[model samples]
Target: MVKKKIQVLFEDEHYIAATKPSDLLVHPFKARSQDRRSLLRSLKKQTDLYLFPIHRLDKPVSGVVLFAKSKEATRLMKEQWNSENVSKHYIAMVKGVTETEGVYDFPIKTDKGLQEAKTSFKTLTSNDEYSLVDIEIFTGRQHQIRKHFSRRMHNLVGDTKYGHSSINNIFRKDYKFYRIFLHSYQLRFIHPFTKEEVIISSPVTEDCIHIANDLFQFDLTNIGNEAKEN
Candidate 1:
């Protein structure tokens, strides 16, 4: 059911973490579409109170998304994220075989300021052609993983901006996967209201898992596979 598919991994008096669907925009940008349902609108239907975002994941990316219930909670959550009190983790399906484990030591900046981003990754499964990766981010930056990991060599599978047409076509045409191969697999942070630490994780969407299983031999029942379905 769509009810179970749209799940809230974490929720409290002040905040909530909803595992987002792939290809859904976190917020509206550039041109608006008839099919577009702004994130705020969706959250509003969940509740009438004001909602705010602690951090934003890209439109094509899927997984744990945080929202604030009030102005005070919003500010507190933002502070926690900026202070590195929150830990971010993700899963990626890349173009080629990768190492068993490695760190993506890259730096990124935004208009307001700059921050050092550390992306740690490891190969979970491989078919000698493609690979499944578990990646973690020590700092938050826009497109940090998508850009740094995609430097020149074979890019992230289905990454149209940083990948080759041939590889993207493998997922698009062959597998009918249009969304990028990225998932916000986990989030760890202190609750704004209770001050208790929470570590929430999410499962990859069905389509993504099927693609990995079919092309890369990645089984859907990996260690973190039981996380809520996207």
Candidate 2:
């Protein structure tokens, strides 16, 4: 088991949000895998409380993950998330330079079938090789960000699943980085229990910052600051 200190971003009676490291499962598979590392189990042990996940992040993706303290709070928070009351923001470094800003209404295929997914992106900074983009997602469809960007030829750096192998190889040899460059930087919504607006922002990992600086001379320290507004 890989032991890592769980970085809790926000904690209250009804909710807890934490920063999930890259390559860590949000929860274990039903059948379970050989690797026993999981974010939920670690949080349960660290906080010594039952926690319910309100949203999920991909195993290779890093950033904010929200949980409810109890089953009732989970139900309420899930309702708020299902509605239009929540905003999710992410930052990514893609293979190609992107437009200044754009919205993608591409539908992602799910177990149910093709579902409508919308993503809005603003190119924070870019060079000839890659673009650092700030993303706002309106839907929670499976692999929404990855699929949408990959379809448009702007595959995320280090995304072996959706990116070009040659491109990824070039980056690996050049930058010597492995994790995918997609991060859930911020989540904002109305508190289901207290009715107060809640905003949870996760800072990009040190690796992410280092790679961005090397690639685009970018600074991710305040990447989510402008997107904090509701």
lDDT of 2 by residue, 16-114 (tens): 888898879898865757777789999999999998988888888999999888899998878767467888999998988899999999678877799
lDDT of each: 0.75, 0.86
* Poorest stretch of ten by lDDT in candidate 2: 221-230
Candidate 1: C-alpha lDDT: 0.75
Candidate 1 lDDT over 35-141, as tens digits, reads 56656567667766577877788778888898888889888887778456778888888877788888877666655567677888878887766788888887788
lDDT of 2: 0.86
Candidate 2 Cα deviation (angstroms), residue 113: 1.8
Among all candidates shown, the one with the greatest lDDT: 2
Scored against the true structure, residue 137 in model 2 reaches a CA lDDT of: 93
Error of 1 at 116 (Å): 2.5
* Candidate 1 off by > 4 Å: 1-5, 29-35, 82-84, 109-115, 152-154, 222-230
